[model samples]
Target chain A: MSNLSKPIPPAGDQDALEVEIRGKTFRGADGDAVRAIDEIAFSVAPGSFATLIGPSGCGKTTTLRIILGLDREFDGRLKLPAGGGRIAAVFQEPRLLPWRTVEENVRLALSDEDTGRDLDDLFAVLGLAEMRSRYPGELSLGLARRAALARAFAIRPSLLVLDEPFVSLDEQTASRLRTLLTDVWSARPTTALMVTHNLREAVQLSDRIIFLTERPARMRGVYDITTPRADRDARWREATLPALAKRYSGVL
Target chain B: MAPDHRADATDTALLQRPAALGRPVFGPRLVTALSLAGLLALWWIAAIVADSRVLPAPPAVAEAFWRDAATGELFFHLAMTLMRVIAAFVLAMAIGSVIGIVLGMNREANRFFDPWLILFLNIPALVVIVLAYIWFGLNEAAAIGAIAVNKIPNVVVTMREGARTLDRDLEEMASVYRFSAGRTLRHVVLPQLQPYFAAASRTGISLIWKIALVVELLGRSNGVGFQINLYFQLFDVAAILAYTLAFVAVMLTIEFLLVQPFEAHSTRWRPRRAGS
Candidate 1:
C-alpha cells in the first residue's frame, strides 16, 4: 500500500552495509560511570529491520545515538557504510515545529527533488490529509505522531532510526502506525533500527530482535524470526513467540 | 484510533457558526469623554472654592486656550515641542537598538556597558537637562540630545532582554534550512523581537516627552515647557492649566491610537491558556 511515486534506489544500491559497535561506555553525572553496552558487537544487515529491546536505562537509546553519530565520546568504533545518505530520526516526541503547519513540517525534511512524492497520498496513508494545514498545537497527539512519521518517511533516509517512536500513542493509533511503518519500510526497505521496551512490538516489526541485559547493557540474546514475510500472522501471539518471551523476560 | 470524534465535531461546528456581533464601537470613546468631563468639573469646582488666581475655572482656561489658538501661538509651541520629542525618540531607538543587540551578542561588551547603562538609568532627568544646558549653551541640539540620552538606557535594557530570550531551536532550524540572513531576520528574529520593540517604543515615547519638557523649561526658547515657564512668570494660571490639559490629551491619544494597536498585533501569535 506504499504510494512512493518515484523510483528510490534499493538500500543495497545506496550505502548498504553494517554498523559495528565495540566496547562503548557512557558516564553519567555524579562521577558515577556506567559502562553502557560493554563490548557490544552487532551488525545491522542492509535492507533488514532490527529491533533493540531491553529494560529502561539499558543503553538502547545510547546504542542508537552512537550509531547515529550523536554520542561520539563513547569508547566504540561504529563502522557505517560509505557515502551515507540522509539519516533522519523520529524522536520519542513528535518534535514537529510548533509554528509550522503539518504539511510544512513534513516538507521541511525534503530536498527539492525529493518533493516529487504525492504529499496528499503520503498524508492519506497516515490518515492525516485533512489535518495538513493544522499546526502541531491544533493536532491531536496521534495526528502529530503521524506527521512526525510522514516527515521521517518524506526524507527517504538510508538509515531510519526510531527511539521509542510510539511510546505515548494509544494502542489503536500505535498499531495503525506500526502497520503503516511496515508498509513504508517494505516499499523502500531502508536499514531500519528501532528501540522499544515492548517485546510484542519487537516481534511484530523486526526481522531480528536483540535483547540486552540490565544496566551496563550487554547483548544477552539474539532471536532470528524465521517466519516467512507473507505468512506471519498475529506474530506476537504465535505459539513459539511465548517461549522466546519467557526465555528473555528475566534479562529485561 | 477512535478519533475524539465528538470533540472534533464540536470544534467544526464552532467554526461553522456565524460570527459574533461586533463590539460596541463608541464604548471606549464615551468612557474617555465622560472621564475628561469629570476632570473638568472637578477643576471648575476647585477654582470656585479657591476663588483666587492660583486656580482657574474651566471657562477661564478655555478663554486662555482660545486666545492662544487665535493668535496661532499655542499651535506653534505645541508643534515645536512635538517635533523635538519625535526626533529625540527616533534617535534613541536607533542608537539603543544597535548597542543593545551588539551587547547582547557579546558577553564582554555587555559587561563593559553594564555599569555605564545603570548610571544613565539612575541619573535624574532634571539634572541631565541642566547639565546639557550648561555644557552646550542652551541650543536646540542640546535640548534634543539631553532627552535622547536620558531615554536610551531604557530602550537598551529592553532590547537586550529580548535578544537574550530568543529561541536557539528556531535558529538551528533556520540554519538547517540554509535560510539567508535577511530572511532569518525578517521572519524569525523580527517576529520574536516585536514585543521588546513595542515595549521600547511605549516607554521611549513617554520618557522623551518628559525629558523634552524638562529641557524646554531649563534651556530651550520654544515648546510647551517654555510657554509654561512664560505663564509662570506672568502668573497666568489659566494658561498653564490649558497647556497641561492639552499635553495630557496628546499623550492619551498616542497611547490609544498607536501603542495599544501595535501591542495587540505583535502578541497575536501567543496562545491564551485557560485562567490567563
Candidate 2:
C-alpha cells in the first residue's frame, strides 16, 4: 500500500511530510558509485507517530538526513507544504553545543516568532528545569538526550525527525526516556517520524512502522498498530510483540 | 545490592587520612620564594667566581634598575614598548582570523592562498622588518606594520586548523534549526574556535613582542629595544640587563593578570581537572 510513486496530493495538507527517494548515489573512497537508497517512498500523516525500522548501516540515517534537508544531493523530493510549521530533529548523538548552557542550547532552535515564549513548562515536562544553567558536557548521557529532545520540541515543530535518539543508552534509561518522549509528545502532538532498529521500541512508540531492508535500503513492509497508545502498556507489548515479531520474521 | 553508604564513607575517610598526613608542609608560594632565592644565591656565587665586568652581579643589575627608575627613563621606554605591542597584536589577530576563516570555509580560496601563506610564514622576521623600514621609511606605522606582519601567519595557521576541525554535527544541528548566519557564527562556530583563538593569542603575544623589539631597535627612537641598543654600544652590561629584566617582568605580569584568566574563563564549561 505504501509503494505509490507520487505523494498523496500535498496541496491542502500542510502538516503531512512527503518524502520520495528515487535514488541517492554517492562516490565511495574507491571512486565507485554507491547507491545509498533505492526507490524508498513514504509519507507521514498529520500528527501521527511513524518509525522507520531497519538494521544498522541500512541507510535509515541517510533517509532521515534527506528528509531533514541536511543532505540535498539525493535524487529525491521532500515536500513540506508552505505553512507556519517548522521542522526539528533529534540526531543519534545529542548535538548540543558544549559551550552553551542547556537553556542556551534549546533557545538556539527558537525562531524569531518563538523567541521569548516561556519554556518553563516544556523544561518541567522533560525534567530539565534545574538543568537550565548547566553546560552539555556536565550533563549525564540521559540528561543530554533529554536536552536534545527539549531542543527539538522547543520549536513547536510541525514535523519532528528523530534518528535513534535512545541508542547506546542503558535499558532503564532508554525506557524512561521513551516514556518521557510520549509524555512530551502527547502534551503537544506533532507529526513525528523516528528511525530505530529496535522492534520493541518501534512497537512501543509508533502508530505506524515502516520496515526497510539492508544497505541500499528498500521498503520491506509498513505496519500500523491499531491499539490506542494508552492501552499498549507492558502487558500488552509482552503479549503482542512475540507474535508480531514472528509475523515479520523474514524481514527481521 | 548497592554497597553500604556508611561503609563507603568510612573507606573514603580511611583513604583520605593518609593524603592529609602526607601533604607537603610548604605551600606553593613558599616553594616559589625558596626557588628564586636559590637562583639568586647561585648567581651571586657565579659573579664572585667570574669577577668580570660582563657578567654583572645581582646587586649591580638592581642598582642599574633603581637608577633608571629614579630618572623616569624606565617608565617612558616601557610605555612605548607596551603601546606598540598592543597595537600590533590586535591588528595581526583581526586580519589573520578573517583571512583564516575565509580560507578555511572556501576550499578553492585556500588552495590559491596556501602558497602565499607558506611564503609569508617562511620570510624571516628580520627581512620583513628591514623591508618595512626601507619601504615605509622608518616611521611608527612601519614599525608597527612590520611587527604585525611578522605574526599574522602564525595566527592564520592556528585559526585555519581550528576552523577545519569544527564539529560538523553541531553545524548540522545549527542548520537544521534554521539559525541565522550571525547566530550560527556567534553561538556555534565561535565557541568551538575559542580554544584556538586562545592559543593564537598566547603565541601571538610572545612572538609579536619579540618582533616589536627588533622593529624598535631597527627604527624607533624610544623603547626598551632602543635603550638596550644604546647600552650595547657603551658595553654597559648592567644597563642592558636592567632594561631586559624590567620588560620581561612586565610581560610576565600581563600574562598572569590578563592572558591566563581569559583562557581559563573561556573554557570554564570544560570538565575541570581533579582537585581544581
lDDT of 2 by residue, A1-252 (tens): 111122333424555678889888879999999988888888877888999998888899999898788888988778763353578899999999988899999987887756677899999999999999999989999999999999998887777899999999999999999999999998877789999989889999999999888879898888888899999988998987887678777434
Interface RMSD of 1: 4.1
Global lDDT of each candidate: 0.77, 0.87
- Number of colliding residue pairs in each model: 0, 0
What proportion of the true contacts does each candidate reproduce? 0.00, 0.84
lDDT of 2 by residue, B1-276 (tens): 111223334444434466555355665567678998999899899998999999999899999999999999998999999999999999999999989888877899999999999999999999999999999998999999999999999999999998999899989999888899999999999988898898899899988888888888999999999998999999989999999989999998999899877876888899754332
Candidate 2: regions farther than 4 A off: A1-13, A81-84, A250-252, B1-14, B17-25
lDDT tens per residue, model 1, A144-189: 7788888877776667788898898889988888888887678667
In candidate 2, the residue pairs with backbone N, CA or C atoms under 3 Å apart (3 or more residues apart, or in different chains) clash, namely none
Candidate 1: residue A161 lDDT (0-100): 81
